[model samples]
Target chain A: MAHFEKASSITEWLDQRLAITTVKKVMALEYWIPKNINFLWAMGMVLAFTFALLTISGIFLLMYYQPNVDTAFDSVNYTIMSEVGFGWLWRHIHGVAASVVFLIIYIHMFTGIYYGSYKKGREMIWLSGMLLFVVFSAEAFSGYMLPWGQMSYWAGMVITNLFEGFSPDIAGGIMNAPGLVEWIRGDYVPGQAFLSRFFMLHVLLLPLVIIGLIGLHFAALRIPHVNNQDGEEFDYHEAAKLYKEGKTKESKVIPFQPVFLSKDVFVLGVYLIFFFYLVFYHFNFAMDPVNFDPADGLKTPAHIYPEWYFLWSYEILRPFPKDPGLIAFGFAQVAFFLLPFLDKSDTVAPANRRGLFKYWFWIMIVDMIVLTVMGKLPPQGIWNHIGLVAAVVFIALFVSLPWVTKNENRA
Target chain B: MKNELKILGVVVIFTAILYWGVEPFAHTQMHKHVDGEHFAYSDLNESTKKGNVENGKTLVMGAGACTGCHGIQAVAHKAPMDAATAVSAYGVNPPDLSTAGGLYSEKFLANLIENPAHALKVEHKFDAAKGKMHPMPAFYGAGGDKAQEIADMVAFLKSIAPKEISPKNAYLDACGRCHANRYGKLDQLGETPTFKSETDTLKHKVAVLEYQDKLKAYMGKLPPDLSIIIRARSEHFLETFVENPQSQLEGTSMPRVGLSAEGFEKVKAYLTQTGDPSKTAREAIGPWVLLFTLVFTVLAYLWKKSMWKDH
Candidate 1:
């Protein structure tokens, strides 16, 4: 791509010094994405839009949301809902988007799994994306608690209480000191300090970190080049060089602008339709009824269910009583962070190769859905047993992925 | 490629319009309310004045004419005029008030009785059908003498409840009529109580509706589950609201639940406990399932093994 060609005076001035146009020409206009990607490829764009919407809406909501034990619940219920001109819309977007972003990221994760995008050189991309997911979850959980509703207060207490697992009781001797939960909560329970700290993480800290990670994720994806269905690398710079040398057919890449950009926008429009539909029509669809009730430290909601996205791990948290269950819960998330290393198939695509891996992957999805449903269902009777099997299968799928992939038939 | 940018540009503009224009419009369309349109559960403060339960029963049963509409087993006053008859004059049936103190937050109940139409419109987003205001007439006017009468009525309504009624049954009887009960669907190992008479059967039918199914939203507000009301609102505030709600929030539709001070105590306890009826059961289930999952891991490991033959 030729830069500074028939440039306007302003473009020439900027390009002559800062090279702003030059950077855009390289990264934006001339950037090449693989031509043979699907609607799944548009997920990155949807995530970016969701993240942006969350930030924008979150900022507006923060203007109204009072981060105090006294005011947090009502700020959302009254001030945000009735006081602010369009506070309801923004609050709903931020609140509902918490679940939607996770929904998008889950699909994004499954897409990675389906195409094996996490394998080989793209490990950093996968790692950062997984980090985003993990951190994003922390962000959502913290924000969910900020409303200081019954669920928020209880969930905040329940989650912070998970740190109690660190305090091991051996022969009646405690290993870790007490108040680990208090330390995180900044009090005996979720109160003033919990709300303040969560407000910071939800709006500022976690988002900033995620923004940095998303940059790294995009950088890693672009640098080694985008992974595709075939699992073969096609370097855009090399392809560009070949095209300049009249070996254009060998260069199977198109500039991201017109090709990927349009698809991403189209996808963004489609994504926003569903996203705003939740915000507008089904705004409370993802919200639990208990959250509408104000927070009460003395009372815990009968079933301490996390939002739907966290249900997979929450289900995994169940069935392992005490320290063992806590350990299993901790290890469940560790599976995703360890996924790239756990899955070592030389063949990238799970299309035909990864036979056993594919079978188990669907089972994993089914298992996760069951686990999610079980998480919402009161833990009793046959449901508990069903949840138990689902949890075992959940961990088993990840545990056996590497070995299963090794044994799977190759393409 | 040029066409692609055009499409992208169009999409970007379309989504922008949808976000700024369509969504907010739709949201505003559905909900037309002002800031502080309704009070937060926590914002309400309870009155410290001790209510007299004896005074409450006298006000309700003696001169209040409360039995003209509401049914109270404790008072042995089942109004001769049923809902069907009342609809001709009142525009809506006066709901059975047997468990009024039990179901409603005291403050909500107080507001409703003091100003029937206003309380429902504000707190519950209640709308009177056919342009008629709420069926319940305002018993306590703005006159100075009305305070004791209002308090006495609330206290009297409060006195009708069974002490330590299981939170689940309380919800079924009081709140189950309007808000949906998620717990009602849970498979109960316990036996249903047997009702002996025609009146008992009707009450049982209404209770069953609340056992687990959801009620339609009143106006825009989902007649909210009282399961968490105790945790949601303080007992004092709950009772104070029921004593005379219009004093705190004008234009609330919830009729004052005419419960005595003793009745208020019993109902408040019941509403709060419903927040976590299965607390112990849920927590206990966690450990047993964990043990089962560990045992099942062996079976799952074998199942994974069977999926492979050569290796």
Candidate 2:
């Protein structure tokens, strides 16, 4: 047991039992952040804020939403939008947050890669973040099904059909790919059973998993501290001692509280301006026009596409024949998790400092953008050829990452 | 500081490129541009400009025989038979002509009265194998100069229409016969009627089923409910489509209902109301929220500077 002074304040009384003071010191007041980091460091906090917004707004929507296929469309478009007061505000917040969260995640991801944040001891941070991304993707897909609209039905049909690739030929007979698809849907096609199960996953199961992974992500960050722009190392214990001795100017670190938090608050304020602008004025981009129609399994939309966030991977799947395309898509999903091992370079430096690695990084970025652009276009004429080339470049870039960085000089 | 600006510049340029590619360029590729010639209802508009309203009313009530099947509710002209009788006899209930003048383009109305199949663009529906012609007969032979008489009737119908109609009323009058507005709580027969007796309730249910079946048979397939049509289609597509169904979709069972420019606006207003009721409120509050956030951002910047002054 640790010695303590007599209790005088509420914090002291709680500290005796819960060690509340120690927790504050460990997580906030005494936690040291490198002084050299920039505004990109605030992206994690932005993502967390977005997740909180999504959770709150989603709860309000859930109050009026019907999980049954027969009433789902009416419940959203009529009951919530027209009957409930200020219901549209909640929906707009949820819609904008769902979309903007992905934007922040992508920025956060590229920031990590640029600073070599996944090098050595920081692998768990990157891995946990990737897990969160996968779960969030699943959550978005499930939530989209709750609307029971034309796009929702057809996108669900298209995505669920991807499981057919799991079935393979054995002994000159087809395996039960059709059975596997039916099992996931709980029927031969997406229907009442499918809607109910997706509602359960969206509202309950996936959220619980996401919350758990968020905890792990933050925990992973605590151990490695945070990566900085310069990728420089310091003796944190000595830096903290200097910081505490009223020699703040000489210290290489600052406390996570007032010094770091002030910048984060400023960034958050800027981000909220952008966010609410979308929520109030430009919300249509987040909503697909075709989703307004009631779901009819018999009729397919003239063009079926996923939300903008999923476009790059969707493009990868489009350029090849069925089996090879599935393989490419699977590779895209799992490739990021293997990033810590892919770049064999010893030094943890920014891409610009590394010779050939800089070109690799930029080419990879441009290729992804090309893939995203090609994804939304109808795969015909020049677009089909462009998509195929972009997809191939995407695969080749990742496969060549190790070789490109192996011969680079240390920073 | 310089590095941050460089990064910001890169982000801005990247976003601009993505926006251009996904929005403007991709849109042009997906939907081909329709020629302006399709929207020019020229000849019909010319005839309608010269129409005589009094002459139109006399012809509509007397020689036209429109009151036999269709009702002119604004002029107190009722169809001889009720809705149930008409559905049984002709396979679908004929729409009342209370707002036809304002609801349809003048050209569409003239063309429709002259040649029902040609104007409706359902010449395919007149299947010789099925021994079926369109339910309504052409008032005049397909090729003739009955433009003046058609223009006058359109003028009479337009004259009796209310100067300002509610979007809900406009939707019901123009599109309610074939299409249901489920989001607005409207069916083909308008609001569902309440019954005092169980027998009457059962009778209403049976009647609705029979009406739907007959309508399906007449149109080949049931017309899609118009609850979300506003969001599902672009404004340009809807305008050209309503002006002439064949201009967008050839051989469609839908007739050129020919709403005057004003009538189509009202119907579109109703659809927008049902589909996106919060659009006005959302846009109204947008700037205020942005202003508040901007002020907060400025204050936060000042606070950050003060906090970091020592370090």
Best by DockQ: 2
Compose the digit string of candidate 2's lDDT tens values, residues B16-122: 78767766677778876765344456534344356779977877787446777888888888877777788878987888888777667767777777777666667
Once fitted onto the true fold, the runs of candidate 1 whose alpha carbons sit more than 4 angstroms away are: A1-8, A171-175, A235-238, A241-251, A408-411, B1-311
DockQ for every prediction shown: 0.04, 0.69
For each prediction, how big is the interface RMSD?
18.8, 1.5
Off by over 4 Å in 2: A1-6, A170-178, A409-411, B35-39, B43-45, B126-132, B141-147, B194-205
TM-score of 1: 0.60
Q: Chain B vs. true chain B: TM-score for each candidate?
A: 0.46, 0.85
Per-residue C-alpha lDDT of model 1 across residues A1-411, encoded as one tens digit per residue: 545556579878777768898798788767877765666778888888888888899889888888988987767766676557767667767878877787678778877877788877788988988888889888888888888888898888778878875435654546455767788888887778878998888888888898898888888877667777566676667876764565545666656755467656655655665665566556544666668777877667666777877877898988777766876797898888887888767767854456777787767766777777677666778878988998988888888777887764354
Q: Lowest summed-lDDT stretch of 10 residues in model 2 chain A?
A: A167-176
B63-110, model 1: which lDDT tens digit per residue? 546777766765567865653355344433455666776656676566
- How close is chain A of candidate 1 to the true chain A, as a TM-score? 0.93
